[model samples]
Target: MIIIDAGHGGVDPGANGHGVTEKDWTLEVSLHQYHFLRKLGIQCKVTRDRDVLLTPERRAALVKQSGAKVCISNHYNAGGGSGAEVIQSIYSKSKLAKQAADALMAAGMPVRRVFSRKGTAGDYYYMHRLTGSVETIIVEYGFLDSAIDMKKLSIRSFRLQLAEEAALAAVKYSRGVENSLYVVQSGAYYAKDKAEKLCEELKQKGYEAFVRRMN
Candidate 1:
């Protein structure tokens, strides 16, 4: 089961972006994810079904009561920044989490860093106190007010694309579980050979490296 928490509803909008309320967008995106999950035959529940305020403890308790297998807290980014990040609490661990993280990386989020505290996943909210499951992550999709992210939002299909992306990931991770890590190096260069050369230099520096070609 998936618990989708649309952060800061009711009185709390969390953050404002280009005149769009954070609460509204979060709820819309969360609902989209929920519907997509159901279409995939995945079970899910939301913290607030509508515009009701929920305390952190209350939200966490809801998750615990639902016997959910995973938790995803939906939120947006603020300021002049945009991208996606998955934040895990310091209390949960499971193969599903790792797979979910990798899927997010492949989903074309601005940032692809998975944060965990000692293999446990949760963010800076009620997720840790409430989640007793194997996988729990906070999804900060992108910055709302930033120039780059605002442009992304202007696209009618970005949020839906995100929902589709995350839904596919959730299906892969929570259902089709896999475990392992691969060496993925990131850099910028004009030519593919430059990347290959960098990989070679790193190998000489006593680190395992591989050159990946990109079109």
Candidate 2:
């Protein structure tokens, strides 16, 4: 499972350009990603489902409580940049976040490096600071202040594509594909003993089996 945070909201409109508010776009993209992940059977939770402002500490708490392995915060850049940038926590390996950046690039969004904060060897965002226990990444979708970037961000279809690509990244990250093989799902049971019994049966049948706890 993953926790996604839509950066800025309500009074904190974030960066603005071309008559579009950053908060609105972040929510749209985050919500779309959440929907796509759910459709793919990937469990996910969002910090805010609507136009509400949440403090960084509050957001961090939510992510921790969700028991998500990863957290992604969505935002837009400003000042003068014309592409996408993925920022990861300093303590994180950044494997999943880089995969996400690659997926975005493949989906037609420009790539502007996946990196950590300047000077410090850790994440600069408050959410990352408080939620360092979990791998956290902040995505600057594109530069809202740049005219070139604005052209792409203004397209609704492109936003949908971004959402789809982001969700695909989450799915890939969760699965951790290392080999091509067959998978047999025995069953999904709420009780631990039932799952253990099923695994034992599969083992007796000469099949390698294990139980994965899901949220």
TM-score of each model, in listed order: 0.72, 0.79
Tell me each candidate's RMSD, in Å, in order: 13.0, 9.3
Model 2 steric clash pairs: none
In terms of lDDT, the poorest run of 10 residues in model 2 is 175-184
lDDT of 2 by residue, 38-127 (tens): 644578999999999898788888987888877888989888778999888776787878888987898889988898774363457777
The clash tally of candidate 1 reads 4
Runs with alpha carbons beyond 4 Å of true place in candidate 1: 92-98, 116-123, 179-215
Model 1 lDDT at residue 181: 31
Q: What are the lDDT scores of the predictions, listed in order? A: 0.69, 0.81
Cα misplacement distance, residue 70 of candidate 1 (Å): 0.5
Off by over 4 Å in 2: 118-122, 178-215
Candidate 1, 1-215: lDDT as tens digits: 77788888888889887887888888888887787677445788888868878887788788788877677788787866567667777655545445555565575556645666442333455576456653667777778887777777656467767755665666566665454333355576878888888877877897756553332
